[model samples]
Target: MEETEQKVGMLGSGSWATAMIKMLGDNQKKKKVLWWIRKEEDLNYVRTYKHNPTYLSAVELRIEPKNLFTDARDVIRQSDIVVLNTPSAYLKAALHGVGAEDFKGKLVVTAIKGIIPDENLIVGSYLSKVYGIPAENIVVIGGPCHAEEVSSEKLSYLTIAAKDTVKAERVASLLRNRYINTVLSTDVYGVEYGAVLKNIYALAGGICHGLGFGDNFMSVLVSNAIREMETCLTAIDPEADRDINASAYLGDLLVTAYSQFSRNRTFGHMIGKGYTVQSAQLEMNMVAEGYYASACIHNIIQQYDLELPICNMVYQILYNKQSANLEVNNLASKLS
Candidate 1:
């Protein structure tokens, strides 16, 4: 592969995007990376405070005003590659205004994980079909990595998946650094699937806590989540990696399930504590993608007629009017 200069554009200015901006500075070459923020107020806030206080607190990042854009077409056209770090739920809507022509030549790497319920597609699948972008041009960055830990400078690793191994390597070259290690994978589907399903389990863990279940119960819930992930993903790709026991999977699940920082896990805890879905979502300031994903994935399973028992359980408790405690109790009793 030619060592060509590449300009990176970030689609959203959330915590992950800000942390990526910091990570990009470590690139050997001097590159102009643009981060798109829709709100003029957010632009001003970042400028004034020199930090993304709303999304990422304590870690201050200085962003250049010149690199911020509100115009999708302009940014997409200017960058060699675009890193889409927005929440999975907003991905399609965010790209609605931009035609395929804008993104035709650029390499797109996605850091967001969630299924589209209405479309019944993963991000890579949705982008390729909707935007006419080729699968070869789509790269998925996933693993058990968390943005909160990243902001704290904790060592983390991610898997980069693409149909073209060469392109995947290039993506690795661009992202790998002292703290972040990148592994290339041919199992794009499995990696992306695991990324989303783990969130469901993380929420389950949080719900256990919210229901006043202690560590022993939480451990069972977490273990069962990993088991569910392996079972479902292996059905899709038998050669798929089973390293979910690692930090990216189990570790991330624990943090999201238990940490005050995890909005999604916290959302589930609220629901388990008797907060209505609407109120629970409202109380959590950031996006709890699992809430939306639970609906979408549950629908996918039904449409495909695939039996995802744990995921279905989550959907029932969160949206199907099933009592959270009853669902847990029923599942626990059955396991015994």
Candidate 2:
């Protein structure tokens, strides 16, 4: 297929989805991009106003009116590549009527940063098992990049991982631009697991910050978080050669743990300030992926008998209702 003729579809409508659309718009080769938004009102609003109504409202949309859709299956059926950018918790629900047959021959890319709640599977594994997509065709997008920064065209780096390096490069080509630098890797398992684990660590960082821990402590916490991440990633994919120091791993962790735009950290901050898990979730307009990830990773640790102290602490505070002060203080003693 010709590069210009390859049709790409985006599933979900959120800040990250908006950012992807903006990136595709900047692609000099592709003229139009397909977008699937769940709500009729949102679809109409974007078509009329050329911008997402609720998220990333300031960025102007460049997609054609005919390309916007409310039906996910239709978009999947028509496009060669489908990008899944929905929150991990809602991913299954969003694809309600879509099935394995619908995903055949399509290149699936997941921009979701959290693991599937009950399944304990990352997006790539979930799609491969449930939707019957080939493992090589599944791509995972990881970042040191935030959607807010992408919207403003700020310089950002994205790591694209697949078992097939050639396919990984193709997807990277579609997303690369002057401001968006792309790096390709074949460590899909490591990249996906690292992405999921970082959010949990970011929450731990936020909780500490909200409790009045200074920059010095945060540096130590994040350093320990990277060690925790390396251990978890190695357990999941021992054969995949990966650098724990790469932007995909350490840089992503640092950004989420420190950035004002990190919803996971914000969610954690609220928890440290004495809010209940339900209350923190209710108050925020966005989904804090770490909240769901904490439970998922906690389950994985139990199954694998892994010693991930930071993940355990976040899980205790969020799921077990242990006080953040008490749990985090205990966590502090264990961190080097």
Candidate 3:
């Protein structure tokens, strides 16, 4: 196999997972793309039709039927790289019964943007601490890039982050195509935490929008949000030398907080429109990571004894049952 054609396995079947398959193929490489789809019917569906019937229903899978599995461990066993794209909330259950030895020597990549719910650990940390994968062997994919645009072949950029530059570039090779640009970073914690915080911030943006705040107020909100993000990232990993304005950090925060494709923003908009958290989730039929992330982050802030108004306001609204109207009013006074 060519260096770029390292047999890569994917452990998801959602829009991002679908888009990843597209990236691997569109990069025009000849590597085998293995996938672990949960449902047998969906597995059969993609195997027979070359497209996922539900998610991203358009791009051809390009994966051979024989390469698809319902078992995640099977996919892990056969590939040199494993991409965990499942929602953070469900990841533990998704990888249930797969032991630490299963991850030995294989490079682990997390395309997940949320923190693991109960543990409050980002996917990279979760994998390192729980699965015992060496920090250098772990890689993370962060965006300004969304799966929706990637499926349509729109130009987008991704920052592939790891402690090891060689490992980061290795995964970047599989994702860089004519339409997708890949940048490498050693700021592993910054990239992962930035991805998580951006969702919380985006949810706040959506809530503000649904409450009738105009672009002028939004500009202020975003400017403030970035500063809050910088403060949080620095507190989390002081040793990581990173630009807060880099595509992995600021670019991700902007798109998530403003883009129509952001499910976190969509979920927050629904909350502002008077839907209960349960009801909004039922309506979206999607997981808005920030809804869960808000609670997890609130706990972290308490441990670090940090003061982040935007993140706290979101946590209060989502978890503490504070009025959205009241919270926003309080939050507005804090922002410049």
Candidate 1 collision pairs: 144-248
RMSD to native, candidate 3 = 1.2
Residue 28 CA displacement from its true place in model 1, Å: 3.2
Residues 1-336 of candidate 2: C-alpha lDDT, one tens digit per residue: 765567899999999999999998887765447999989999999999999999999999889999999999999999998999999989999899999999999999999998888787888889988888999889999999999999999999999998888989878888899899999998898888888899999999889988889899999999999999998888877888899999999999999999999999998999888888899999999999888888878877988789999999999998888888998889889999
TM-score of 1: 0.91
- Give the residue spans of candidate 1 off by over 4 A: 1-3, 47-49, 239-255
TM-score of each: 0.91, 0.98, 0.98
lDDT comparing candidate 1 with the true structure: 0.77
RMSD of each: 2.4, 1.2, 1.2
Against the hidden true structure, what lDDT does model 2 obtain? 0.91
Candidate ordering by lDDT (highest first): 3, 2, 1
TM-score-superior candidate, 1 or 3: 3
Q: Candidate 1, 286: how far from true, in Å?
A: 0.7
lDDT of each: 0.77, 0.91, 0.91
Clashes of each: 1, 0, 0
Alpha carbon lDDT at 310, candidate 1: 70
